[model samples]
Target: MPSSDDEATADSQHSTPPKKKRKVEDPKDFPSELLSFLSHAVFSNRTLACFAIYTTKEKAALLYKKIMEKYSVTFISRHNSYNHN
Candidate 1:
């Protein structure tokens, strides 16, 4: 027969293990040049916002095409009602 102390140790060993800590990705580690062209503004309404990417017209067209291809036209239009100069 195991002692009470031994039984306690055995019970602890069989119990649930501690959860592992989650690793958060650092935004500073991302390349600066990739985001350098982008600018954003948020409206007081909270639902309204806009993003402007500073690049050549050709690149802008290409990016818009890619976004449109991936997302639905209605979805894009609904969320893109706001513009900031």
Candidate 2:
């Protein structure tokens, strides 16, 4: 036979409230999630380091040229920033 304590415990378990569902932010809306992250994670920080994974130096150089052309102000003038691992 079940004890009185077991019955009380089972009753309390059933009475417990269900956890509220978490609402995830949609990325499709602009200023988009990409923009949101760029603003906070990149722009907010005065000092920033970027890394690129490429098959060859040529590929990395392509992006480096574009970044220099567009956002030269944000560029860190350090050879170490683009060091090979």
Candidate 3:
């Protein structure tokens, strides 16, 4: 014969635990397959780099250059013009 307050407390204690939030990794930060997937996105460097407040223009320029180089490599691979002598 438990009191109503005791029953309520027991019910609250038995409630399900909070669901664990899924951890999504940042694509640009990973340098994984996402790099290729997002290669063609317009203004992608500016957009993605916006995630961090302190990302400097120099750093953005370097990242954009690297991404462009990767795109050029992929292009040359397809066209066989890697060395246009």
lDDT of each: 0.56, 0.52, 0.49
Q: Alpha-carbon error at 20 in model 1, in Å?
A: 0.8
List runs of model 3 lying over 4 Å from the truth: 28-85
lDDT, candidate 1, 1-85, per-residue tens? 8899999999999999999999954444334544665444433655333444344445767777787897554543212222332
> TM-scores of the models, in the given order?
0.28, 0.24, 0.28
- Compared with the true structure, the alpha-carbon lDDT of candidate 1 equals 0.56
Ranking by TM-score: 3, 1, 2
Error of 1 at 19 (Å): 0.9
Ten-residue stretch with the least lDDT total in model 3: 76-85
* Model 2 segments more than 4 A misplaced: 1-55, 77-85
Each model's backbone clash number: 0, 0, 0
Cα error of candidate 3 at position 60, Å: 29
For model 2, residues 1-85, the per-residue Cα lDDT tens digits are: 9999999999998896989999955343232322434523434636555532223445666766766787745543322223322
Spell out the clash pairs found in candidate 3. Answer: none
- Candidate no. 3 TM-score: 0.28
